[model samples]
Target: MATDHQGPATMLDVAAHAGVSRATVSRVFTAPESVAAATLERVLKAVEDLSYSPNAAARSLRSGRSNTVALLVGDISQPFHSQLAKSVAHVAEDRGYSLLLCDLDHSMDRLQRLLTVLPLQGVDGIMLATGDAIETPGIRAAIDAAEAKGTRVLLGSAQPDSSMALTVSPPFEEIGYLATKHLLAQERWPVALLSGFKGSVVSTLLRAGYLRACLEAGHSEKETMVLDAGFNSTSAQRETAKLLDGAAMPRGIVAANIPIALGAISALADRSLSVPDMVALVACEEVQLAEQLRPGLTTAGTDIGVQGEAMALALIDAIEGQAATARALVPHLTVRESSALS
Candidate 1:
């Protein structure tokens, strides 16, 4: 009679089947270069037969380095962040590294816990993308600890702190300035600013740029139009509706980001306003949805995927101590149907 008990296959079983030591099997999986080609082939064949996958934790314990990195973002659901994550994952795979993603959801406490756990789990590096300004003490401490452990950290679209390493994102002020300036060039004076969160760094810079453009165009203080729409579509729609209901509405509107642009379009539709006929609209970041809208949105933006790839490469360099300079990618404007006036 056959016994019913059967133990799961392990690295030792694969090593025995391949006629190699346990260390050789570990090397075959973790550091393939360290194993001879013939030996690696044998080990791989044995692994396939046994349906064995290497244990990442055990390999990291023996190798003193985890071939894994963590990407932390403020809002994972946002189109920009989702695209960035995909880009990073692709690059990480090319470099023989795995990526772990964590969404902070704009919570300081959750971000802190992620930082704490990532290092303990032997993550080789971290990429941080905060939707707003980076000002939390927990974030600062996490950066310091990662640096102390010789783990690389890269930040995108976040203000740099002297204590941590970073890659500068597209100049948000430039995005805002260019969007508003485009409206102004169309002979649309007194453009209204539909801003994001009050304290967000991107919002502050964009707002300042819009105001500066108005001043440069010789618009009076009262005529330098502005409105705070907050973030997200619902808030933007509500704020924009209020503006439409008011006694006066600006001839042009500058939305802080893509989501705001979508909301602004909806609000205008509700008021039976036509794009570039009654009012012109411009947005800071352009996504696919913008183009699919009834009238494509004009926007000032940089390639988010390219930025993500650059950030990953930069973080790898920092991790290996090869480079020490902060890098910045510039923004460019794209003209679309929404801003066209015929």
Candidate 2:
């Protein structure tokens, strides 16, 4: 629906138009104080266009009882992680809570610096979306200390000590298995798997999933190769170019992220080989470019926003002294022309 053309829009209506959760709309109107400044701006604009106003007084009263949740992200450029953050923002908004985003410098040491934010009274909880840094005991302990001081702590992905904090994420392994299987089903053999950064929890989980699919399909180890592409377009491109220079080309490929998938496509183009005709491809995360490609990319996608909202709610529940701890989201496959057989 168009932004400005709505009749007596409801909170849910505002969220639908904004591509966020209904609770987010409520948070915008009722708990503007608790909502993230960025989310507040977006929701306010949506409210104006929809010609709807929230019960500001009632919301304000509710906002008094709630505080904002903070989410720390190491890489906002990664499509999958960015999608998850978008979802978290909506969920936080819906619950009449604001979100604080801390863009880290991608160093474990920086996490220590971010810990200083936890002591602030306005920070109700802290969510760690840090990639490999979750493995660092210092980081984990610092987050735990925040929790000990009455701020709830949650994790978007796995950590070295999961029991120390609540964890929520999609079935990552299933996502990888599904993507790899899709490529294999296209009758493409010797499928190459472009795994993400070395030692990344997501990379390990996804690589295992891809291996499961290949082995189940009777493909041998030599038939598939795994590379540590480091989860960026430039790194992926460089790594894939080296693979392209090898003796034999892969007939199919499973990319663990959008950058790797795009890198693979670019490398193939440099060699004058056509996608899907010479090599079928699948991406683990769905992004707009997937649909915009010359022969659109097939991807394994999940309702990350919904999952993020759920995690937020779970954190809220945990803060309220309830027993909710963990939840897993399942991914759905989206088929497009890129992985289709000629």
Candidate 3:
């Protein structure tokens, strides 16, 4: 076993095995253009046989570059974040860079602390998901400090400060408007929204878009209901029960996220009312679950993987001093069984 020295084979092991100096081995791997093709072949062979890997820490210390990108997502459990994480990891690894995925679970304090130290640790770039990571006041100084230390930053969502920072955003406001409009187009009176908690930037924007569409269609708040369940499926269930039990049920509902949509469907099932037959349903964002459900969910189809890759590329370009900002993704509605009138 070439890596038999115990933990892992070092670069020196490959160098020794290849009959070359450690510097030659390093040059062959890092600056192959400067190394002779014959030496490169020998080193590559030795690298394969010894299975030796370069230490990122040592390389960063020697070159002042980490060749790593960090992605901070608010919640990995969310379908959107999970997709974003997968794409970011894939692209980072493909580009010969290590990826650090940090799921903060929506903790602002933890994100602030992480931002504070990312520069000192020589992280090459950062990809931030929405919410406190981009909106919190503490993160600005940290971002500035990191930029001064040569760590580039990109955001996964659009915000008020988006013009100042590179951002890759899906068609957010349009998604809400499209989903709500689809519900309204069914001629379903008294529409509602399962739009997460109040004061959330995402939920707020989505709600505003929904409201804008409704108002334009001559509907008022009296005919529109916005329900809050803290973005939890179980909470949405309870809220749905209260909505059905205590008040008149809206003819149509728009779920701000896939989870909320699932919860809403479950709640409706509890009442033995079939989707679209009893009430129309649509979700602002499409996910895998939307299609797999009994009544395929009508949704605003936003490509999350594209959003993640766009941000990753933007961050990489920024790191390399190339100005790159992604274009906003336009969402298209996917009509399905759930929103059909029965």
Q: How well does candidate 3 match the true structure in TM-score terms?
A: 0.79
Model 2 bad stretches (over 4 Å)? 1-66, 323-328
The per-residue C-alpha lDDT of model 3 at residue 270 equals: 97
Ten-residue region with minimum lDDT total, candidate 1:
1-10
Candidate 1 backbone collisions, by pair: none
Question: What is the C-alpha local distance difference test score of each model?
Answer: 0.76, 0.73, 0.76
Supply the global lDDT for candidate 3.
0.76
Candidate 1 per-residue lDDT, tens place, 1-342, comes to 111225657778888888889999777644455566577668767865775645445445535667788898888877778888898899889877889888877776656556644564567788888757766776788677766755677777757354554665667877888898899998886588999886677788887788878878888768775777776778899988988888888789999877788898899999899997888999888666667777988888777777778888887666666775555677888888888978
**Per-residue error at 167 for model 2, in Å?**
0.9
TM-score of each: 0.78, 0.76, 0.79
Q: After superposition, how far is residue 233 of candidate 1 from its true place, in Å?
A: 0.7
lDDT of 3 by residue, 8-46 (tens): 677788888889898997776444556776777687678
Error of 1 at 157 (Å): 1.7
Error of 3 at 226 (Å): 0.8
Q: Which lDDT tens digits does candidate 2 get at residues 141-258? A: 7776667556788777765446765777667789999988888887787788898887688888888899899999998876778988887878888888888888877888888878
Backbone collision tally, model 2: 7
